[model samples]
Structure formats: C-alpha cells, structure tokens
Target: MSDVVPVKLRPEILAQRAYKQGQPAPANSFKLSSNELPFAPLDSVVAAATGATEFNRYPDAAATKLRQALAEHYGLTAEQVLVGAGSVSLLYQAVLAAAGAGDEVMYPWRSFEAYPGMVTVAGASSVQVPLDRDSRVDLDAMLDAITDRTRLIIVCSPNNPTGTYTRQDEFERFLERVPSDLLVIADEAYIEFVTDTEALNATRLLADYPNLVIARTLSKAYGLAGLRVGYLLGNPRVLNAFNTTAIPFLVSAQAQAAALAVMQEADSVRARVNEITMRRDEVRRALIDQGWPIPESQANFVWLPCGELAERVDEILRQGGIVARTFPGDGIRVSIGEEASTSPLLAACARALERYPYLRREEAEAE
Candidate 1:
C-alpha cells in the first residue's frame, strides 16, 4: 500500500496557522482567560430557549425573526441585518465576500488574531498595521497601508488583547481617507462593555458609509458566548453579499430564541453590563495599586504589558488555581469575570507581584 496521502490541501490552507482560542483550565480553577460574561443567561432568555419548539426542524435560513429583533434593538431594518453562527463566522464571511485571490485585507496587528487567518483562508493577502505605543490601533498607519488592491479593512474597537478603543473622531478621519468601494468591517464584539459616550458606534456610521459593515454579538456582554449567535449590520448590498456567502440555517433555533429574548430584556442586560463595568474598574484599580503595569481597558478585561513577565505571571496565577492568558513575549490578558472569578485573580495578582518583584521592577524601568 502507498504511504502517500491521496490529496493535498489548498496552498492557502496549508500556509495558515491553526487559530488558537483561550485555554480552558480545570473546573475548580477560575477561568478568566476567555472574555466571557460572568453571569448566567437571564430567566427570560432561559425560558425562551426552553420554549423553542422548532428544534425538531431546521431553523429559518435567513433567521428572519432574530434579525427583526436585532434591527428593532439597533434602529435598523431587517434588510440591513445578517445573522450568523457567531461574530467570528460573520467576520470570515465578510472577508470572503469582500476579498479573494490577489486582493489585500488590512487590519491592526495584535488586534484580532483571527483577522489574518480569515484573510488567508479567503485567499487574500494580509497587511497588518502595527499598533501605537499605547497599543491602540494606529488609524493613520492603517490608512497608509491601504492600496488599490485593498478590499476590506477591519477595525476591532476596544480591541482584544490591548483593550483600547478608537475614538469617534479618529474613526471618522480614517473613514474619510478610505476608498468608498472598499468594505470596512467594524468588529464591536465588546461594544456593550464600553462606558464612553464618545466611542464610535459603527451602526450609527453605516447610514453614511455605504461600504461599512458592523459585526456585533451577544457573546461577550449578553452572556451568550456558548450559544454562538451574532449579527452583522450594513448596507443592503453588502448585507446581500453576506447572505450569499452565509451557511443555510447557521444559527440554531434555541440560540435565536435566546438572543431575541435577551434583546427584549434590555434593562436587565444593561444592569448586568453596569455590574461588569464596575467590576472591571475595581479590578483595574486593584492591579494598578499593586504596581501592575496595566492598560486602560474599556472591555471586560485588563491587559498587563509585562512582555516576558507574562509567562511567569500566568504560571503564578495557575498555581493559585486561576488561569490568565499569556501572549508569550508580548504580555498578559486577564478577563474580569464575576466577583467569584475576580477575587481569586486579585489574590493571585498579589502573590504574583510578591514573587516576581524583580520582574515588576524591570517592567517599571523599561517603561
């Protein structure tokens, strides 16, 4: 028998690195690596999920009812809404719909790791604009990176890892410089957690920018990460493209029901968001008080810019039965979960600081 494999995968697929998600630690450990909502789904959402009777049948291919709910929530029409399995899936779909072989996709480096991978998988070239010193998206640099071949530009505000947001004015300036034909995807996965009124809501910008697309999810702030439900809002033409590329019945009946139910309970969701915001601030202050070099996080997490000290801090936290994300030579990203989660993380931070005083000193000196 021949030992050789029968078929070779696509060149682009072969060249891409496997996407890595935050690690899941032991059950007893405080799982703070993934930026998931600490609270459980509200009673209304749970009831909606259980009350869904269509599990025996295929979900609405277009997710009509769910889209309507989202449109009403965001003051958009159902025609402008496109639902997907998750924002991650919609991201891939949007990139695929915009760019293909020979085209280029540009985004901020270390913003969303998925951006580069999605571009590659869609047979497109990736141009990464490095972040600024503060680890915020360098809008000017990203605009400079754009070329005729550029088909899509992704801006992840309250960016993952860095947790920095691009203000409205900055975003508007960048948008003015970009070509109208190019698709601009604003990934607002952490939008609900943002406390700043000046933060740009891509949805509000959509009416003026025909090529703009905004992807949002119930995963982070709405506590529906496990449900894999997210939606995209954009011009009818752009949304039509997403609809063409989307998988049929991508969102499940239960997920749709829960998402719709959650949207109905806006006040409840806002209350939960308020709690998370307070906790996030408290955690940030606690870390700063301990002399931890943390960044200003508008998301539900804090970023420690300790570079090589990231691994050591992660190990220390792990030993205390807590898990934080370590970006090897970059830094650490710690999620602010429930009070139960934050207590252990705060204690672990104290222990880590005590054990690695020299590392902290080095970080301070380098800064």
Candidate 2:
C-alpha cells in the first residue's frame, strides 16, 4: 500500500506496481538483461529516420505508407495493418478495447511480465494458465481456463523470459477451439529469432481466423528498439477497433521512416538475426555442458532455472561482468548479445552451477 494521496485515485491503480525495465549494467559489464539486439542500427534505417527532420509537424496520424508497405510484405491490404509505437502499445489498446471491469484477460503465467499489468490497467482480471513442465505455454490448459467473462487471450510464442515457443500444430488446435467471437493475440515479438521449423508463426493462420491477430516488433530482429516501431496484422475490422483506443500520432515521423527503411533491409536484418541465433545455441549448449540444465531456447536468449538461488546467480554473473535479468525465486534470462559476451556468461554460469550443484536436472532428480 502507498501513502495517502492528496486526491482520490483508483485503489487498484495504487496497488499496481509500474513496469520496470531490465537493470543497467556497469561500464565493464555486458547488459544481457533486456533482450535487445546487440548490433547497431543499419545505415539506411538511420539515414531515413534523420531525413524525416520536419520537427515542426506531427507524424502522419494514419502511418499510411509504412502500413501499406507492411501490408504488401504480408500479402494483406493496408487497412489490415495497424502500426503503433511498439507491440506493447497495440496490446494495451486491444485489451482496453475488448475488456473492462468484470472481464478477464487470459495468457500463460510466467510468460511476459507485462500481461497482468495490461489486464489490470484495462480494469479486467487476468487468467494466467501455468506453463508446462518444460516452461512452454500449455495450450490445452489455456483452453480449459476460458470462461464467459474472458474477453481477450494472448499467446506469446517463443514466450518472453523462458525462450520456449509454442508448436504450430498445437497452436492451430488451440485456436480452433477458441470461441469465434473472442479475440486471440499471438504475440510474436521474438519470432524472427526463432530457428525451429515447427514454432508457431501465427501470421500463416491469420487469413483463416478472423478472431486472431498478430503482434510483432522490429525491435528484436531489425534493431529498432529505441525507435519503438511495431504493428498488428489481422482482420481490418478488429484492427479498426483497436485503433479507436490508441492515442493519436503516438508513432513519431522518425519512427515511421525508420520502420519503412528497416522493412527494406530484410536481408541485412536476417543476417544479423542468424548470427544471434547461432550464438544463442552455442551459449545454451555450453551452459548445458556445464550442468546448468538450460532449457531449449528458440528465442534470442536462454533460461537458467536457478529456482530460489536466482539472486545469488545474478550476483555471480554480475561479478563476472555479465548482467542478466533475474526473476526472484525463479531463474535468470541471459540474452544473446555480442560474441564477446559468451565467455563471461559461460564463466558465470559455470561458477553458479559449481556452487549450486543441485540445480542440474540430473542432480535435482536424484535428490
């Protein structure tokens, strides 16, 4: 509870904590806390953003050209695309549009930490289905949790923090079972990092399901995190409803230009993503070899299931000049950054594992 305010405010709002970004690392340490791209922005993208120097004017309220380009890339009409500051903004708009007091928003627990807060801000309840033993979203369990009050469902593929993805077949089955009138958001924020052929892309099934929408961002693969460009692809009507709840001209002109430029730099972006994904695999393999019991990661990060020793592990990594995102009592999320980060990251994990030998899967099971 907070101290008394001068004016009245929603009790729930008072109780709710604000979203916290990943911690900043010291100068000598690699900040692997946020799952950010390690590479610098492409020259073309930077030039385009700087070229939009009309500071006196507001951005295009509709973001028409960028939306059209994205539509063309995805084989859809411009109206089917709704661009926003970032995918997170679009998600909040969707929740506010579809849910309200007494309504429920559903998603996997231990998924994106932002899910519950979005629901709360919408005056809606959150129904968090627990992840399976492998830390993957359990689609069957999600289907079983739907209630009449449920207004929105979010499925995060290559789910945040854990780095595990939903299978395409399982997702299709889950979507088929979802009520046609209900809205389902496939949050593919980290889709570009996924190397697994069987991982759910969501866009492939967008044509078949009007109730389904895809939320994606250029932040990860295209390295546009600072510009905050993201979009939604789905039925035009559904996007229209979401747009109604959006703040006007929130996407700046520079951001729109950067988005357009980045779209055209797909080859370069893919190459960068390939390097990160390869590095991610190598890091995961090394950790597993060190008996850390790392989960199979399809995203640009790996999960270290440190359990109650998360704080200690985080400290050890910090001491080794590596800063990872640590969830107290849960685990750590080590992002795939520059190749130079690998040695220190591995060293930190090895030290943690040696100190906490029971953290290994085999050791834990035997205990």
Candidate 3:
C-alpha cells in the first residue's frame, strides 16, 4: 500500500482512518466486546424478514409502514418519524443537515466514539466537554461550551463505554438553558435497557422542545443490529431535514418487516430486555465486590476504569476467554453476556486486581 494517491481527496478524510469495530473473539471465548444481544431473534421477527421476498425491487424509500408503526407507538403523526439504516446513520444525517464549515457540533467527551468523526465528516468543528469526576456527562460544562457557531448538540444517555445516564431533571434544565434555535439530539440507543425510572427518556419532552429530536434503534434491546433498523422522532420539519440528507432506500425491505413484527411482539421483547438488565446488575455488583470502581450502568454493559492499565487488563480478560472492548489508556467495556460467562469474568477481574493492586479506586485515588 502506498501513501500517494492519483486523485484528490478531502485532507481530513485522508488523515482519518475508517471506523474500527470490536475485534472478533475466538470460538472458545465469550465475545463481550460489541455490546450485542446474546439471545436469538423471536420466531415471528425471523418469519417476517424471510417473508419479504422482493429482492429485485427497491425498498420503500420512505419506510412508510415502519414509520407509521413507530409514530403510532409514540402517539405522533407519521411525518415525525424518520427511519434509517441505524441510529448512527440517522446521527450522520442530522449532523450533515444541521452543520457545515465554520459551524460546530457539541457532545460529551468519552461518550460515543462516533461523535467526533461525524462532526469532522460534516466539515464542522467538534466541541467536546469533558465528563465529570464520576465519568458522567456534565450538563453544566456542556451548556458553558455552547457558542453561536454551535449548530447541534448530542446527549447520549447511558453513554456508551461509560454506561452512565443523565437524570431527567438535569436534562430538562439543560434543555431550558440551551438556545431554542439550536438542534439537540438525544441519542437514546440504549434506553431500552435502562431500569432507572428517573433517567432522561427525552421522548416525554419532545412536544415541549421543537429543537429536540430523539434517536433510537432496535439494535441492542430488540436484537435487530444485523438488520440496521433505527429511527428519529421529532417535529416533522426537523425530521424532514434529516430525511433529505439520507441516502434513499438505505433501510432494506427485510429490516422494515422485522421491525414491524418485533414491535408487535412487545411482551416477548420486554422479557428478553428484563433478563439482560438483571444480569447486567448482577455483573456490576460482583465487579464492585471485587474492588473494581465500576460505574452504575443503566445500559447492558459495565465499565472497568483501567486507566493506564487498560491494555494489560484486556490481556488478562482475554486469557480468561473473555473478549471485551478495550480502549488502550481509558477503560474496558464488558457486555453482560451469558450466565456461563460470569464466573470467568469475575475470575479474570480478580486476577487483574491481584496482579495490579493499585487499580482499585481507593488505591488509585491515594496515588
């Protein structure tokens, strides 16, 4: 591979690498890196996806049926719903629609890894406010960071990797202070796993905030990651702007059918979600018992704040047949996997703590 290119390309794109995904685990290992559901798809969902046989024709560009379903569920008209390949895709559309050169997009740092890249691709500068001491997004800092050039702001509840959620009152206060003309996206991709009654859902405040839009996906809770069915809920005018930026027919026929079928199977979906949330709580408690400074995660994963020892800790987990998402200097995000994985996960954490005694919060803070 040569660095030289025959054609011109955006220098920013040239300097940046494509998004990297979680590493695949060995067949014998428990793969907990990607935060995917371990359960199988419900029979009805599979049947509906398989039943969509029109491979030769393009999917409904509008995703009418899926939009109608989502709109009805939220008590909104169909115009307020915009479906896309995934919530990530919808986010990209939002950024592109609302921002450009000389503009800015803001979000919490150490939140979603995708936020910075999205801003760069939109030719907008990123304004990332650092998280608080507890690794939670500091709403006050985000409000202070906002400027006239800031066109959009994103708030990811149950923030990825950190697993912390913004409280409902805190979020409402932040929204009240934010400029009403600016667009704010509440990325609730992991909201389905949250058990905290007071956590910010964002949907409840939609009618009051015309500038607010909520992005959700069937990926984590509904086990529809492979199909990439996600959507945005907001004012029709705002949603229409995002829709204009979307690549037509990006959501496939199979995804729409699966989404429709799964929406109808709400009882079954809730059961599966409950199972995972329970397991998640158990894992967090066990990690805390082992002296790990695990954050209270409303999402389906736990964060191990390994700091500078992240790479070493990842090696320890790997040796225990656990493949987790590791950020070299930050921390490791271990998904709450099968019950069979619990023992090994705990064992690995114990070993790591033994080998590096300073990793525990009390010891690390003393340093």
Candidate 4:
C-alpha cells in the first residue's frame, strides 16, 4: 500500500488503520478473542430492550433515565453523569472535547487499542507512555512524559489486553501531580472483574478532582456489548462539554432501557463477574505451573506475552480450537470464556510452549 491518497481525506486518517477486531472462531472452536461475557443477555434486559417499541421516536438525547440510574448507583446527582453509546464512544467524545490539532492526549501504550484511534480522530497528537516490565501502567513515567501541550491523560485500570492495573495510592499521587487544568480520564471498562481492593476507582475520587472523569460500560459485566451503553462520572461542567461533542442520540432508546434494566440486576452481574475472575485466576495459575510466563491478570482475560513468536502461537491456539486474540509481534490475549474453553486453551498453550521452548520460563532461564 502506497502512502498516497486518492482523495482529500486527512493524511493521518489515510495512514491510520481502523480498529481490527479479534478473529472469530470456527464453528467447532471457542471464541476467546473478544473479552465478552460468555453468558447471554438477561431475560429482563431483553424484555426491557424489546419494550422500547417506539423506534420512530428519537431516543432521549439527554439519556435522562439511564443517567439517573447510574448517578443513583454512584451516589451522585444526575448532573454529574453522562451516558453514551459505549465507554469507547464516551472516550472519543472526551478526547475531542479537550483536544485539537496542536494538543497531546496521553495514555499508557499497550493499554486500550482504541485510545490511539480516539486521539487520532480528535485531531490530537497521541503521547503513549510505555508500560512497565510487568505490563502495568507506569504512573511515574506518564507524569514525566507530561508537557505543556498535554490536554488529556487516560488511565485504563485492569488495562485491556494485559489486565494489569494502577493501585489507589500511587494513582492518587499521580493525580495530585498532574496539572489541575488538564483533563484526565480513568477508563474502567473492566472494573467489575477487579478483585484487588486497593485498585484505583476514579469515581470515588471524583469529588476531589473536578478535572477527572470516570468512564465505565455495561458492555462487559452486564452483557450489553451488543446494545452499546456506557457512561461517565465527572464534574457536571466537564461532562456537559463531552455531551456537546457526542453524536446526537448515540445511546439508542433500547440501549437505555436495557442499561436501566441491567442496573437492577447487580446481584446476578456480580455473580457472573465473580465466576470470570475465579476462572481467570485459575487459568493464570495453571499457565504458570506449566512454565508459561503468564502475568497476574485481575481482569477477565490473560495475556500471553509470546513476544516475536506471537503469530505462531496464535495459529497454534486456532489449531486447538481456541480463538484467542493475537497482537502479531506483541502477545496473545485469551479471554476467560466458558468453562468448556478451558481444556483446549491450556492444551494449546502447552503445545505452543513445547514447540517454542523459549517462551517457557524454565527454558528462558536455562539460556
């Protein structure tokens, strides 16, 4: 592909690749690529969505009812919350609202794959702070990377693809160091899976930092990914700015109703989240015992850092009927899916380690 453009599209947009989703599994394989809940949408949620039959009427641009539910759950007022099609959409809005051509939007690299795209779409330069050796966000490095051009800094807890997180104390210290005028977004899309009590919950710190915003989604825990409903908690004024940048009626009426319904199903959602977390820990431990250098994943996915052997391992996973997410030269992220996926996934990993012994911890140390 030449770096030539046939039309008057933005050069950045032309050079940039759109977000590529994980590969789908074959008929007989388990799809552990996307970090989606293996469970189906709750019957109550489905009924609520279906009940929103007035398709001809435009959805509430304000997303009032859903926002109210979220606000109530968070012990905040409706003015402090902003709902969007999904947390990713809200992230896009936040970037666009705060940044433009000359500004910089910072986030940990190897964090959310969507962060770079959102920054690009907002016409802002992306400053990606490299993750630490453990694949966790290095708050100190991020603070060091900050400069006058910085407008927004996004912190993804239980970071996507890696499942690492920033702790509360360090995060608060980092927040304190950040320029007060600069906007900060805490991306908590996988928060429900976090078992660590010390983990950063930016929503709790919202009252302390007017510039801070917390973005969360029902897509992960509530099985609302298909419905596309997520929201933000922050200063009413800041969220108001974000709302202005959002695509009108982005959160569909069905989505709103579904979100509202799911909010009431907290007990069931918690139970499912607990199941995934338990499975994640078990899988991670099993991989470790097999001499694989798997990290401690608090989220509902485990990252296999295969380094240069990523593609080869990906093919191996596919061969074993386990469709995990592969990031070429980086690593493979296997979502904690149905219990049925466990045996095949571990078998594939074991096979990969046997074929590429260098990825095994013992083998690496021997070298």
Each candidate structure's count of clashing pairs = 0, 0, 0, 0
Model 2 lDDT at residue 176: 89
Model 4: weakest 10-residue lDDT segment is: 358-367
- What's the distance in Å from true for residue 353, model 4? 0.3
Per-residue lDDT of candidate 4, residues 1-367 (tens digit): 9756666988798677799877788899999999899998889999999999999999999999888888888899999999998899999999999999999999998887888888889899999998888889999999999999999999999899899988999989998999999898999999999899998878778999998999999899889988888899999999999889988988899999999999899899999999999999999999999898787777899999888899999999999999988887889999999999999999999999889988997765565
Arranged by TM-score, best first: 3, 2, 4, 1
Better of 3 and 4 by lDDT: 3
lDDT of each prediction vs. the true structure? 0.86, 0.92, 0.93, 0.90
Give candidate 1 misplaced runs (Cα > 4 Å). 1-6, 358-367
Comparing 1 with 4 on lDDT, the higher-scoring candidate is 4
> Per-residue lDDT of 1-367 in model 2, one digit per residue for the tens?
8677979988898888888888999999999999899998889999999999999999998999999999999999999999998999999999999999999999997988888888899999999998988899999998999999999999999999899999999999998899999999999999999888999989899999999999999888889999988999999999999999999999999999999998998899999999999999999888888887777999999999888999998999999999989999889999999999999899888898888889987985565
lDDT assessment of candidate 1 = 0.86
TM-score of each: 0.94, 0.98, 0.98, 0.97
Could you tell me which 10 consecutive residues in candidate 2 have the lowest summed lDDT? 358-367
How much lDDT does candidate 4 score?
A: 0.90
